[model samples]
Target: MDLSGENFRIMILYDFKSNLTVQKSFVRLRTAFEDEAPCKTAICNCFAEYKSGRINLSNEFRDGRPSTAVNIDGVRRMIETDRHVTYHEIQTSLGIGMN
Candidate 1:
């Protein structure tokens, strides 16, 4: 899996396996990484997941629509048909948004 920030997670996992408390792990990370360390909440969440049997550090899918699904041809046609259309109009026509 991607090891980008997994190093920190591995540190957490190691501390967890070594029977350290969450606060201890958080302190260890802060000592090791200082400002570069993930937030305390991040440490807690990652540690919680690992405790719940999630061992890997890859990204998990969260609840949300994909950020962008624009149809280029559809947008081109809409713009060609009406040059005055606003961005919201195009978004409405394409049916893609946070809602």
Candidate 2:
């Protein structure tokens, strides 16, 4: 699937509620998993995974979710790691130049 913009928001919402971070929510869900023993459906899969002690919720979501931020970070890390890279390289590809 094309997981670009809208999908990103969906992921954020899925990961966070109100003001709680995804990590904190997963920790809470993990504790509940031991008590609730919820169903095997996909909607509850993340909670299940946390319950089963299989994987952290964030990691599960991280694997399932598409990350445009990671893509940008990768490019930035590459540029930082390699001095040869330049804004001109990107600009020329887009047919734009610094003023």
Candidate 3:
């Protein structure tokens, strides 16, 4: 079964609504998706959110800065300027934390 994206999430929601335990749901998902299945922690998180009355199935946006704010042009320029520059040096110069 190619239960990769929306179908996978929808299955989780269905299991939640069907009163299936998180462990049971996780097992089913792992059996269906094999290596493509999400981790157990992810299943737990989804079940927790459902129990908390969350129904939306998509990722919600956070208000803080995006995870990746570094500009590609800036990185390219830096690499051009210092061919041997290490990632640590680039991070230090850009004032960005470990990505």
RMSD for each of the candidates: 5.5, 13.7, 5.7
Q: What is the TM-score of each candidate against the true structure?
A: 0.59, 0.21, 0.58
Report the lDDT tens digits of candidate 3 across residue range 1-99. Answer: 455455666788999999999899989988877888878887787788778887666556422367767767877899999899899988888876784
Q: What lDDT tens digits, residue by residue, belong to model 2 across residues 12-37?
A: 34554344555555455445553342
lDDT of 1 by residue, 1-99 (tens): 233576777788898899888899888878877878778888788778778887885445432355666688998999999999888998887885735
Better of 1 and 2 by TM-score: 1
List clashing residue pairs in candidate 2: none
- What's model 2's lDDT at 54? 51
Candidate 3 is scored at a TM of: 0.58
Candidates 2 and 3 compared by TM-score, better number: 3
Report every candidate's CA lDDT.
Answer: 0.77, 0.47, 0.78
Instruction: Tell me how far the alpha carbon of residue 42 in candidate 2 is from the true structure, in angstroms, after superposition.
Output: 10
Error of 2 at 11 (Å): 13
Clash pairs, candidate 1, are none
How well does model 2 score by local distance difference test?
0.47
Query: Using lDDT as the measure, what is the rank order of every candidate, best first?
Result: 3, 1, 2
